[model samples]
Target chain A: MTYCVGMVLDRGIVLMSDTRTNSGVDNISVFRKMFHWAVPGERIISVMTAGNLATTQSVISRLEERSKTPEERSNSLLELPTMFQVAVETGKLLRETVQDTQSENGEQGKGRFTASMIVAGQIKGMEPRLFMIYPEGNFIEASFDTPFFQIGETKYGRPILIRGYDRNMSFEDAVKLLMVSFDSTLKANLSVGLPLDMMVIERDKYEPAHEQRIEATDEYFLSVSSGWSDALRTAFHSLPNFSFGQPGNG
Target chain B: MTYCVGMVLDRGIVLMSDTRTNSGVDNISVFRKMFHWAVPGERIISVMTAGNLATTQSVISRLEERSKTPEERSNSLLELPTMFQVAVETGKLLRETVQDTQSENGEQGKGRFTASMIVAGQIKGMEPRLFMIYPEGNFIEASFDTPFFQIGETKYGRPILIRGYDRNMSFEDAVKLLMVSFDSTLKANLSVGLPLDMMVIERDKYEPAHEQRIEATDEYFLSVSSGWSDALRTAFHSLPNFSFGQPGNG
Candidate 1:
């Protein structure tokens, strides 16, 4: 399982993904789920994937291969006119990969090879765009009312996002909010592990503003995890207590 | 759908349940999920249920009916010598109820009529106990390491319980902890709704020490919900920001 979140904030886009993939409890491995491509001031795109590892790897590799060949440059990420086009083409590749794998493995494997992705980035002239692409080649873009998308192991981290998200918040605060969300998921589920990949894309930059790998021993991540827990305890203690209506209690 | 939680602490026990039941989103209604039976100084038992509402209602009704009849009183909740016996008997009744309903409806209804329960209480001379009874007439008791059990829509709220649970905490603190857990679940899910039922049983007392129905307009609950959100935002801001490694940024 993987847990990834991408936010389309006013300042830019923040994308975070955990690097844990498991076939079973004993067969767990670390696999980077975030892929990025940049052509300096022309275009920048990042894809965060969840679901079938094989399918996502195939789709990503095909995109990379096409980007390198002059003959396929028209359909490559580097040449996509807009982020929406990149998302559409990425979804198509994902669906085709799943279909090919299913046919190779036959009928019983029909739904076994499936993957979903969050595509976010910008072209020089257009504003930053974010989209959640489904396994069936359909996709939905983020809106003002719902400026974020999460995939895989999402429920545990969702309450924090619902309560704390602000569309106009700073990029620093956006990263902080996502860290809390990911920390909540990490504590509740063993399937999602550490060594997180995070990218920040400032609006109109057409390149990554910042990117980092948050390992288990990262000081700032540890501080956020423990600080959030302590803050919750303090907040709980500050709440008004339920008064009993019994004799001498109220 | 429902959300119910029960915890065994060093001081005693705390149980809470949301009052929502739905066949579908359009068919939601408020229904109390907590039931209690007590003989004052003899014993006190509370059952918090989740899953099929019809099955749980039938099980509770049967227990109540048997407890009222003089001839069947020997096998009733009032006659059970220990909390473990009460749990075992409750599991049996739950299994019987599901089996009867399925038989009446035939093969297509095999798993449609099923419910689970958290049974917590104490008999004179025994310590307070907690058990989660499955639909199969089997149950597991909570241990010191895992002193709480939650049923239905449990994942969203589980992280708080994992981080905040303390066996030595006061009953008031325990209630506060569960309020946070339930509030988290309530926000993320539409199926778990307002007007929660809470009960506390002090060890060896054999009766409820406090009980309340928390409505939507309840001031204390409102404070906890809003305060928790504010505290999280503050905590997020207090964490160190991720510094870019470019020139003049560090």
Candidate 2:
């Protein structure tokens, strides 16, 4: 299980992903699931993955391998004409990677592996875009009605997004909302772990405006966790009771 | 899909259930999921069901039918000597109901249908108890570590329970927390709908201490929904930014 979210706001785009992967209860490991590509001022694209780790890693590595070779790197993320094209190329690679890996184990390559990705970024001339790529290599771009996309362990964190999201929200507030959303998910699920990778891209900047890896001991996250708990306690106490039975003296 | 939660606190027991049932996106209907039987001063039992409404309704009707006959009423809910016996009787009825329904459809009687229930209440002389009964008829009582049980569409509302639960919490506080949980589930899933049924049973009392069906137009719930949205937005704005960078004026 995993949790990754991408938001395309007026100010910029925000992407965050947890780093835990588990095959079973006893078989758990930490693996960074975010990959970034940049061509300085020309373009900057970040991809966050969830689902089968092996399939995601293979797809990302194939993209990287293609980028290293001058001939094959033309259609790479760094050279893509637009963010939409970048998402399309990435999804094709993801589907191909899952197929190649599953075929090696004598499996049919259909049911053995399934992975998904969130592609968000800016190009030299196009507007900042966000897309959620499916395992079948198809993708859907975010619209004003749904300015964010979340994949994996999404339910626990969705309410915060639905309630707090605004089309005109500043990038700073968006990141904080995403943190609270991620914070809620991490507290409820063991499959999502820390050293969370986050990136913010200012619209039309064509480069990452801010980026950081949030560790378990980060002071801001610590404050957010304790503050939320305290706020909930306060809110819980403030609500009026049933008041039916003479405000029970017990 | 459905969402029902049961909590056992020091003050008493709290049970809440949504009234919507959905077979698919196009096939949704309103059905009550909470059932109760009271023997006045002797015993009171409330059962909330999720999954396969037909199966659950069958089980409750069977119990209701048994209570109608003098001889059979001896083994019925109203006559259960203890809370534990009440749970066992409910579990047996649930199993039998599923078997009868599935066999008539020419499906395997054991695994063809899935149903989960949260049973909570008290016998006149006993402390309140809460039990979660599974499809296999096996049930587990809530403990200090996990003081509540939620069946159906549970993941969306689980985070609040993971951190907000407290056995020493007052009945008012407990009910508030349960409402927050239910609100979150309602926001994230369309299958869980309005007009929630809630019951409160005070310890040592066999009858319902307080009961109400929260309709969609309830003023308190409306306040909760709007206030929660504002609170989340305010909280999001108060958090620190990436900290490593200046406010990206880019």
Candidate 2 whole-model C-alpha lDDT, 0 to 1 = 0.82
lDDT of 2 by residue, B98-182 (tens): 7777777774554766798998888876788999998777799988778889999998888778767888877767767777888
Cα shift from native, residue B57, model 2 (Å): 1.2
Please write out the lDDT profile of model 1 over residues B93-211, one tens digit for every residue: 99999999998999888788999999999999888999999999899999988899999999889878887888998888887788888899998899999899999999988888998
Q: What TM-score does each of the candidates earn?
A: 0.91, 0.90
| DockQ comparisons of all candidates to the true complex | 0.46, 0.40
Question: Model 1 TM-score?
Answer: 0.91
- Which candidate number maximizes lDDT? 1
- Going through the candidates in order, state the TM-score of chain A alone for each one: 0.93, 0.89
TM-score of chain B, candidates 1 onward in order = 0.93, 0.90
Stretches of candidate 2 above 4 Å error? A66-75, A99-112, A237-242, A245-250, B66-75, B99-112, B237-242, B245-250
Interface RMSD of every candidate? 3.7, 5.1
